[model samples]
Target chain A: METKKKKPRYDFILILILAVAGLGILAFAFLTGGGGASVEVSVDGRIIAVYPLSDNREEVINTPEGKNRLEIKDGRVRVTDADCPDKLCVNQGWISMKGQSVICLPHKLTVKITGEEAPESKGADIVVK
Target chain B: MKDNKGKNNIRQKQYIRSVTSHGMLVAMAIVLSWLEAQIPAFFAVPGMKLGITNIVVVTALYKMSSPSAMGINILRIILVSFMFGGPSAMIYSLSGGMLSTLIMILLKKIRHFSITAVSIAGGVFHNIGQVAAAAVILNTDGIFWYLSVLWFTGMVTGTLIGILSSQLVKRLPDSLFSLRSGGTK
Candidate 1:
């Protein structure tokens, strides 16, 4: 006896639901990019420092994995340089908008822009690190 | 004595066939994973993957027993991580792989959803596991904020994988799968 193959059926409703949900989240991520006044830097998930966007300075972040140079100027922040192999963070460019972040996965470091009024909680408004 | 010998011979042949089939699936999964790693992330968000490897996992789940599918999935993660990634990568992949596999298995057992739904759930759970691992390693709750975006990516990728796997399974020859035992439905 031949074992008949079953034809695969797709649930269009499930796909539609997922598509709507996905688009909603993507929209939220983009729409929330308001101007931010401060940038918070974290290494190994701990907040190392918070620099005001009003200040123009370069700070070198050193962690056990590697080192990264963060440059803050003109209300924008970016990783100017890093020793990590990919250097993805350096290429991510500057972010001065709320909910924007620059992350170095190799070094497990993250820099995020925050509003002038720091939230009492240390958690990020949007986790992109 | 003759009957026992014949049965033993058939069992040995089945075992060899099963191992070979599982090995082929693992190799396919590894190649897909490697291919995915070569493509630059489309989104700026970290840890985003196309999840093409999931096609093999989903196919395995439907075509073989839960244990066989799971064994193949775990083996693929370990081998791929060791070959292409660092210790941290291994941890993240392991966490994600295990969680996704568990969710898929549960969903499969329920039989209420289509393969696409199961794959989507697997994708979402995989991201959650990775985020949880990152949060623990980094010691920050900040990573949780990334979950929303990850979930969005997961659903999109998962749906694609689900469609691909369902088609692949339909095309596969029944003889390639062990018919003697260790298959559900």
Candidate 2:
């Protein structure tokens, strides 16, 4: 005679809570819209360079793995070329909006657009006081 | 002496059955992962996936031991990565799969939440693990921005897999899982 409390069944409430939370965050992200005027280039999570979107320029980034060519033209940025196998970064096209970004997974490079000024910290008031 | 031998024989049979069943579950997980990869993603997010393969892991966890589920999940990641993606894919998948499985097993042990909640947590952790791996490989914290978006997607996909696995658990025969538990008739 096995005696163990029957495993609790699926909780719809939990699922609903998760769904609401996920959707809420997504909605917030969408509503924020892309409004940046500059693109920030990062490698391995650290900002390596920043370029104004109004400028037209090209940069070749070299790392231990390989090189990736980034081009900023007409207020948009993109990975024009890369030595990575899949070339998915080059295929990602241009990003010109505040939140738009292009990432090269193979090279661990990311180019993300940002507003002219950094957004205020989410908990700035609480932390500062 | 006769009773001991009989018991040993039963144990041997159970072991063989467990091996075969676990093998089958691993195969199922691999195929599911591969199939999901073939489908064009609805979203533009690079790593976002339907996570259909998780259904097998969840089902295995419910039906067998956590170790068995972990083994099956890991094997599926390796096999599917080899078949569909290359080495980079393998690294991401291994990191994400291991983290997700660990989270799911821990949640299962807690028993406070339902299977759906466990799966949801697994999904969230899986994305976090992958993002973390990508950040390490790329050496950039910029990738963290993807976390919120990925978490949202994870929740959606995890809920889907949870619902599916729940239905599957209900339909599957007890005999399918009885070998490991030693409930053979």
Candidate 3:
């Protein structure tokens, strides 16, 4: 039979690419810890506020955006309500671990996990740069 | 004219298949959506909840078409909202779901990409989509700030869903169509 040169089908390409993307995502997740370090957001090393995942329940964290309610109901910390526009920080569910942070750009307040320390920064100072 | 007519017939047949398949997808999306809601948010941020919805959305995107996934997601949202959650969850789900669907679909088509990349892309897009949705729904641009937070979470969660989906696809081949085939896209 005279054969026609078949065109390349992209269905498999989509699956392979999705699989790779999944791998990349897996790498990032495994590398980063979901169990974030407990951090106190502050200005100039002086922790103006603190959010401990173990705190159990919503606590008012004083940020640049006035008094916003932050909670640790499940296994992470999240801003329940913020005066800041967009309320994005409030929408972000939970944060627990390295490289994870909750930011309120409009309010200039950032709650982030710097690292796992010996609780020095806990009682010391946390300055926002 | 004869050749053109033949091509038209083929195109029509393909369209019919797509439409019917999409309907089935919507039904499956509904089931998945319900299942998604039942998954207790592993971590609860008051006014927010988390689950494996992203994985299903990403998996569907990988296995099916973009519009098909989108349709399923939309149906899932409506059904789940009706079955559980209030109008609030629906708002966030719509924004995040649509974004995840669009981004994953694009990344899946990217050259030399992997499911890992698609998963991460899904994570990032899910955040962007939700933040955008928040800004629109809340009518405030400040929502973008939460993007950083969501980004990290997305990376973490999306990867998990991706891995799970990958494993699932391996165990369940395409033709088996009878196994829990409540697929949306």
Per-model TM against the reference: 0.80, 0.75, 0.49
Per-residue lDDT tens digits of candidate 1, residues B40-153? Answer: 755567777888998889988988777877888899999998999988999999999889999899878876678878899889889988988876886543343477778878
Against the true two-chain complex, what DockQ does each candidate achieve?
A: 0.26, 0.22, 0.06
Model 1 chain A worst lDDT window (10 residues): A120-129
| Model 2 chain B poorest 10 in a row by lDDT | B138-147
For candidate 3, give the lDDT.
0.58
- Candidate achieving higher lDDT, 2 or 3: 2
Top of the candidates by lDDT: 1
Q: Superposing all C-alpha atoms, what RMSD in Å does each candidate have to the true structure?
A: 5.5, 7.4, 10.9
lDDT of 2 by residue, B44-145 (tens): 677888889999999999877899989999888888877878788899999999999999999788777777788888898899899888767765433444
Q: Could you tell me which residue pairs clash in candidate 1?
A: A127-B145, A127-B146
What C-alpha lDDT, on a 0 to 100 scale, does residue A4 get in candidate 2?
Answer: 45
Which of the two candidates, 1 or 3, achieves a greater TM-score against the reference?
1
- Model 1: how far residue A103 lies from native, Å: 2.7
lDDT by residue for model 1 (A61-123), tens = 887899999898998999999999777788778887777777787988988887665434454
Q: Model 3, B162: alpha-carbon shift in Å? A: 0.7
